[model samples]
Target chain A: MALDGRIEQAVVAALALSKGADAPPRLQAALDHAVFPGGARIRPTILLSVATACGDDRPGLADASAAALELIHCASLVHDDLPCFDDADTRRGKASVHRAFGEPLAVLAGDSLIVLAFEVLAQAAGDHPRRAVDLMRILAQRTGMPGGICAGQGWESEAVIDLAAYHRAKTGALFIAATQMGAVAAGQDAEPWEELGARIGSAFQVADDLKDALLTPEEMGKPAGQDAAHQRPSAVAEMGVAGAVSHLKDILGGAIASIPSCPGEAKLAAMVRAYAEKMTPVHLSPVRG
Target chain B: MALDGRIEQAVVAALALSKGADAPPRLQAALDHAVFPGGARIRPTILLSVATACGDDRPGLADASAAALELIHCASLVHDDLPCFDDADTRRGKASVHRAFGEPLAVLAGDSLIVLAFEVLAQAAGDHPRRAVDLMRILAQRTGMPGGICAGQGWESEAVIDLAAYHRAKTGALFIAATQMGAVAAGQDAEPWEELGARIGSAFQVADDLKDALLTPEEMGKPAGQDAAHQRPSAVAEMGVAGAVSHLKDILGGAIASIPSCPGEAKLAAMVRAYAEKMTPVHLSPVRG
Candidate 1:
């Protein structure tokens, strides 16, 4: 199966237990609502691509890793859109989890998903114990504080922010998780995959800033100009749109170049190049220009 | 060392990564605030006790399981005190996470702690890979949906609530985890330990309801009559304070009787008896009466 199909299947399996007859219907529905109709599925896709590049000897573990990374990503989005944070009303072109389900269920949904992500990895640990352990550790590291996305969010509350560290953690952590976990899932060294993931994450953040600064709410399907409204630090706010766009191109180039010595290095580069195109808008596409 | 000391040491180690200089200062503070000055440390104590009863060959894994369970409990309390949920201003005799650090930081702190729980388990995997995986899976199951605490919270939102399931999930889930995970940490079967945990959890919930209904805010160190205020399901409300206290006695009796045969059965029973005495109020003490 393709990466997309594998991701969906794995996510379905991970959520099956929660959707049972005895489960609370609304929370189960909220779980479904948060995950389904996913946008891009980029993190899991990168995870699988990296795993494939590293031989993917344990396909089951790789699929679980992919699903786990995406679940964490989804979980973050749910929490990010809560009233205390962005108060975003829309996500993936639909009502945000909090908007659709109310604040309590939204909070519970995000928490459940985070727990479920780790649970999925542990469930898949039957035969691939070491790899599963590695996947959980890496995912937890990227999901939590000090160096994870939670730390990234925490940076926002700081009186003075270090833009670089903030972006590295808030934006780059999970992308790094995707690559590192992917490599670990396939029995490879996780360290070598970090650069590629970081670069991809940095490029995406820049691209996101460009979209928020340049696009309308209709175009983005959620609130736009949020960074400006919230007085958040942004690449586009610091660097002009043109400069941010250029920076994105540079980062994507580095990402492709940093594929490490994998069996399918060329294939992974091609995949990154494809994503680079998708990430760069057509009007200012580096490839088009 | 005793279970209490082991639990504290393990929790300290788990939070070390998040307490570094680089972490968001407020978030680090919030993490410490939430976990420190713990209420009873009852859950972890229960977990370690069960592990010891099962012949704990791996103290490290037992410690991790204990800490992980406590972290999950702390995370839940942090969220429960959020404005959207219980809107609780205090917990554990002090300002709740939200009150102390504000809403955003509280949310992030809770998320960070939840991730930290799984990470603690994975980090302890080492040579105890199987036990580690079991621990993570069990912890996640109790933390998340269907039968977990999240499911317990979700039952509140439903129009038609299953009272038994609600109590089983919200209060009983982690208690079950404490016993099941304790057994798993000691390389024992988890199923047989469920009844004891369930009875203990049920007793705690009743005792909590009794406190909420009877005690003043000064006595409880937090809000009182909350269950009645929120119109939440309460054993005291349903069964009356007298009947609820009696039910507490019955559950404690069952809890002690339900202990599975183990190397330290007598010791475990004694510990349960101690908790039973603690759980029952002076006016309602079954032993005194």
Candidate 2:
């Protein structure tokens, strides 16, 4: 199956488990809204790609890991868009979960998705117990405190924010989880994939900062310039748009170079290059000018 | 160690894992405040006791299960007290998490705790991978949709609520997790223990409804009469106070009768009896009249 179809199937199956007759309709609807019409799904794609590069020994576990990472990412988006935080009115060209479902159901939906992620991993443990545990650990480490998305969100409230650490936790953690979890799911050592994940993740953040600074809401399909509105630390703010773009290019080069020796290394490098080109600031390109 | 001490240690250790130097101070404070000075520690206590009754074979996994159950319960209370929900001012005689940490931190703290629960379980997966997976499944099943606490909370928003299903999902689910997880952690069948958990959980809800309708905030250490305030379905509302009290007694009787045959069955029976006595409405006694 195609990566998007596999991920969508996994997510749909997981959500269906919760849709008993007595299940709360609003919460269910909010969950579907938050998941469907997903963004680029870059994180899970990287995960599945890495798993394929590592030989894709356990297909079920790999699909579950990819689905779990996306679910956590989706949950974070829902929570981040809450009135108490960025208060985003729209996401992916539609109303944010809170805007559509009300804040209470949004909170519950985010929470339900988080639990659903773990439940998916646990259910996939039927034959590959060790791999399942590794997947769970990676997902939890990236989703929670100390160096997860939770820590990333926590950084916003701090008097002092370490720009690198903040970006890594907030955006890079899940990306890193994608790479490492993919390798582990394929029965390979996850360490070799760490640097690749970090570089790609950092590049992705820099690219996002550029978009947040330069794109209009119409262009981005979400609120724009949120970095400035929230007074949040951003690569564009610290380095200027041109400098941030240059940094993104440097990180993408490093990410391509960091791909480890594997049977599918060439294919993986090609995928990273593709993402690099896609995320490049087209308007800033001299050729475009 | 005593059950309370074991549970306390597990929770403290889990929170400590998140207290990196970079962790947000306010979020950390809120997480601590939500957990410390916990009210009764009822859920973990039941979990540990059930594990003991099942032979306490895997002590580490059992302790982790107990702690995970309690952490999830704490997280729910924090979210329940949010402004969009109860907007309560106090919990366990202290300011609620949102009241103390502000709504943003409260949401983050709750999210952090939920992830922490799974992290604790994942960390315990080393020697007993299957058991760990089982524990995770039971916890997620009770914490998420269909019949989880999330479903319970969702029931409140529905136009029609099935009181039994609502109570079971909202309150009974965790209790079921406590029993089932304990058994699974001990390498025993979790199914046999389900009825015991369900009956006890249902009984506890009735007792709580009675307290909410009859007691003062000072007595409950939180806002009272919230069911009526929110127009939520409650035993006291469905059946009058006297009828609710009688129902509680009957449920407790069934709970005691539901204890499955095990080596520690006698001790488990004694524990249930003590809880039943403690939760019995004092004013309903003839001696009090």
Q: Supply the global lDDT for candidate 2.
A: 0.87
Pairs clashing within candidate 1:
none
lDDT of 1 by residue, B1-289 (tens): 3677778898888888566666788889999999998878999999999999999999899988998999999999999899998999889789999998999999998899999999899899889888899899889988898889999989888899988888899999999999999999999998999999988899899999888887789889999989989898898778787788888889899899999999999999999999888878595443332
Q: State the lDDT of candidate 2 residue by residue for A1-289, as single tens digits.
A: 2687877777787777667877877788889999997888888899999999999989888888888898999999999999999899999999999999899899999999999999999998888887888889888888888889998898787788777778888888988999999999999988889999989889888888888888789999999888899888888788887788788889999999999999899999999998888889478552432
TM-score of chain B of each: 0.96, 0.93
- For model 2 chain A, give the 10-residue run with minimal summed lDDT: A280-289
TM-score of chain A of 2: 0.96
Local error of candidate 2 at residue B216 (angstroms)? 3.4
TM-score of chain A of 1: 0.94
lDDT, candidate 1, A1-289, per-residue tens = 2788888998888888566566789999999999998878989999999999999999999888888888899999999999999888988878999999999999999999999999899999978787789889999989897889999999988898877778889989999999999899999988988999999999989888888887778777767898899877788788777778888889999889888998999999999888888888685443432
- Prediction 1 global C-alpha lDDT: 0.89
Candidate 1 chain A, run of 10 with poorest lDDT: A280-289
Native RMSD of candidate 1 (Å): 2.2
**Chain A TM-score of each model, in the order shown?**
0.94, 0.96
